[model samples]
Target: MDPGTNVLDLSQLRRSCSSCALSELCLPAGIGNDDLERLDTAVRDKRTLDRGGMLYRDGDPFEALYVVRSGSLKTFVLDDSGDVQILGFHLPGEIIGFDALASNQHVSQAEALERSSICELPYARLQQVTSEVPALHRQLMRVISREVIEEHRHLVMMGRQQAQEQLAIFLKSLADRYQRLQRDSTALTLSMSRYDIANYLGLVVETVSRLFSRLEEMGVLEVNRKSVRICRPDLLAELCRSSGVPASKRRDAG
Candidate 1:
């Protein structure tokens, strides 16, 4: 795919909803054969992005919604100083590019943090098909709402400056997403870079590493490079909750 067109070739697109593993993540249930076929047609392309490759850059014209079928992506915006401020890291079964739905232009760049495949749903065609398939429209709306809620959760989580609170919540969020995908939540690999994680959490890379060591010392988790094993999720959650409170407030309440 050329950077100019930013389009995937048609023949490479996966054209089946019935057998797709991620169908339940983004597709409506009880869909008839006709509606399923319509969905297959609506998502006319599947794009591939190599690690460090961008799905779309900021200011690009938004043409479609991208659903991650495999691997991970990071969405980031450039500050006035041109520093990257990571907005979010996306996992399998998640959708990106919705932030541009109103403006018809990308507000952030979505890049693959690993080799990834994404199903591209053409927004124009999707609108037409969803009008005929009310369930599909409802599913899209539900997905949008869920994104909003998740973003809100992240906003609150990041408001805390303590490494314990920030990293514990971040780990828990990843575990929850893995559980949703029926993958092992206890043991997992974080494909995103430490730098990206630091940027997203408003911390330095060294701080991120230090927090991981602290978590290991607490026996809450074990970290091996990008690999992580949650040894005590309950304890981790407790730390996330308590560490976020101001020290003076905690003392007064105590």
Candidate 2:
């Protein structure tokens, strides 16, 4: 009954899944309150990561899954030439570490794009709780499905689209994600570097820079360094569609 122990417990309770702001967008979505409390117990650790910190490296053991409570992260792998090939950027409320599930080891590295807070759920405990909570299991599948869809979208963009359409699809996808978070969809800050962006989009750095300038001139976007404001979202959407990329299907978490 120590007073300091009681205070620490209260602090942790405030960060529990039931009290988290991203509950609806995260694993707690569509679960009963009782189930949320159970899931919260499974999330054993909440940690802070500084910018450029590596959460996991290629071929590392995957002991737990991480949920981004704040800030952003990028996942990438090294090419045969030892060059970094960017995979994807992860925003707040998204999950990472699924890549390890298939082989029980991570094949890519995840690094923090900024100082961030993350919640960790150990795999064994998560499996135990999900088996007892059908709703939680269903929600987990939905999150994983979204990740698969995004990968397919990226592959299509890289293989078929021109540079302009590729950039358009990337921006439009970010705007959609922002909108889902109930944030301003038209404005976005690029958390990853231009070189990383170029790598992810399969374009050179110069081409990425020139496209930003070209989009600005066309009034489709207003770019100031890493900050971008989609001045004409309609035009941006049109560009995405013009390349024959299928329209994005908005999946509901609930």
lDDT of each: 0.85, 0.87
Q: lDDT score of model 1?
A: 0.85
Candidate 2: regions farther than 4 A off: 1-8, 28-30, 243-254
- Candidate 1 structure quality by residue, lDDT tens digits, 154-231: 788789857778888888888999999989998979998888888888889999988889778868888888899999
Q: How do all models score by TM-score?
A: 0.89, 0.91
Error of 1 at 145 (Å): 0.9
lDDT string, candidate 2, 38-134, tens digits: 8888997678899999999999998999999899999999978999988899998899999999999999999999998899989999999999998
TM-score, candidate number 2: 0.91
